[model samples]
Target: MILNGCAIVFDDEKYFSLSGDNVQCDQRYYITNPLTTQFHVKYKKKKEFSPKLLVLMTMSSKDVFDIYVHKGEQ
Candidate 1:
């Protein structure tokens, strides 16, 4: 991705080196975390449980993905 005569770099941590034509560049970092969620549903007579999900791209936006129910230890 180039914007206003500038090259954007993207390396997924498995590369030998950059291609030719390198003369100074800017560095950027991005994080990737795989989150897990568990949900339970009981269906009868061909019925299913579906939940609504939303995705936001703004920095000041927030959304809830799932809710957890914990059990007490005996």
Candidate 2:
């Protein structure tokens, strides 16, 4: 998903990458909590934000993504 000017690509069940104004030109992030649809983004070790929250607030109500709930460890 692309948010603001950044591109967030979920590589798998555990990895994702961010690239844009705040993010480094080359960097990848690993999901610390994959069970919940929550994650964090840090820029230059200073600025930080939650992409999930941004999506929930900025995205229109018509826009929605499939949500999956995991009961146990994968």
Candidate 3:
């Protein structure tokens, strides 16, 4: 099953290029964690997990309909 936190960024005309603020152009989403007291029992002792960004522009059809999740210059 897919997690709730999965997100994507469309490489639309406005967001095709990685310019200006990268965060502002990319779309962000988070997975929903089931609420349960048992789930957070080891919150303080457990490791934190960060969300991943997946790009779907290349996988999509059409030149003008591509969406990208670009990682700015290192």
Candidate 4:
């Protein structure tokens, strides 16, 4: 999955991808502004669920990004 100019990979294979100005993910509607470096996820009203997973990415000096997954609240 890619978010805010960052690419992420997960073992589960359930991931979101950027489609134009929108972020496509299961059970959520996330919109992204390309001009900004921050993005967030908004859940659907009927299918609302808490975000139990937090993904963090840091950009390295070599221009590569590293992804880290943390369970529970940050």
Candidate 5:
């Protein structure tokens, strides 16, 4: 697996990164802006695979969401 990049932001607060391990892993989310109390995290994962296998996974909670997937040559 490879970490592409991350640009997560909520309530005027901003976060950036280029490393993450398995989208299904645990992550922490918080509200950066005081004025905004509600926020959402949207994650999208795209897997690169050979021409033989493909997989996908998506999970969400009351305040967090994650999307993962694997694909093959079209």
Candidate 6:
């Protein structure tokens, strides 16, 4: 997770459907911010089950992330 530094807050998309038939495809949630460690990745999609969707993050990284993004208005 970002070269073991970890910091991605949230980049989201999660839709829900399906009433029955036990569902569990992807789920992982962990966030401890003292030293740093963050990961909340999800992956699940169904087409025939009335179209369900969950792809919370798809990151292409260059590594090193402690959380810093305030370059101020360009």
Q: Which of the numbered candidates is closest to the native, going by highest lDDT?
A: 4
Q: Evaluate all candidate structures by whole-model CA lDDT and list the values in order.
A: 0.29, 0.38, 0.40, 0.44, 0.39, 0.41
Rank candidates, TM-score, best first.
4, 6, 3, 5, 1, 2
What's each prediction's TM-score? Answer: 0.17, 0.16, 0.18, 0.25, 0.18, 0.19
Q: Between which residue pairs do clashes occur in model 3?
A: 4-31, 5-30, 5-31, 10-67, 11-66, 11-67, 57-67
Instruction: Supply every candidate's count of residue pairs whose N, Cα or C atoms clash at under 3 angstroms.
Output: 0, 0, 7, 0, 0, 0
Summing lDDT over every window of 10 consecutive residues in candidate 4, give the lowest-scoring window. 12-21
Q: Write the per-residue lDDT of candidate 4 for residues 1-74, one digit (tens) a residue.
A: 33666645433313232222233454444356645534343322332334455566665434555577665431
Q: On TM-score, who's better, 1 or 4?
A: 4
Writing each residue's lDDT as its tens digit, candidate 5 over 1-74 gives: 24346444322222222234334545645556746553334443535531333333333322334433344343
Off by over 4 Å in 6: 1-17, 23-48, 63-74
RMSD values for the candidates in order, in angstroms, are 23.5, 19.2, 18.0, 17.7, 22.5, 20.9
Question: Which residues of candidate 2, in runs, are more than 4 Å off?
Answer: 1-62
Over the stretch 1-74, how does candidate 2's per-residue lDDT look in tens digits? 33666644442232222324345754666666656644345334533532221111123334535544333221
TM-score of decoy 6: 0.19
Candidate 2 accuracy as lDDT? 0.38
What is the RMSD, in Å, between candidate 2 and the native fold over all Cα?
19.2
User: Between 5 and 6, whose TM-score is larger?
Assistant: 6
Candidate 3 lDDT tens digits, 2-73: 645554433422223333223654344344653633543424342233233445543323234545565434
**Candidate 3 global CA lDDT score:** 0.40
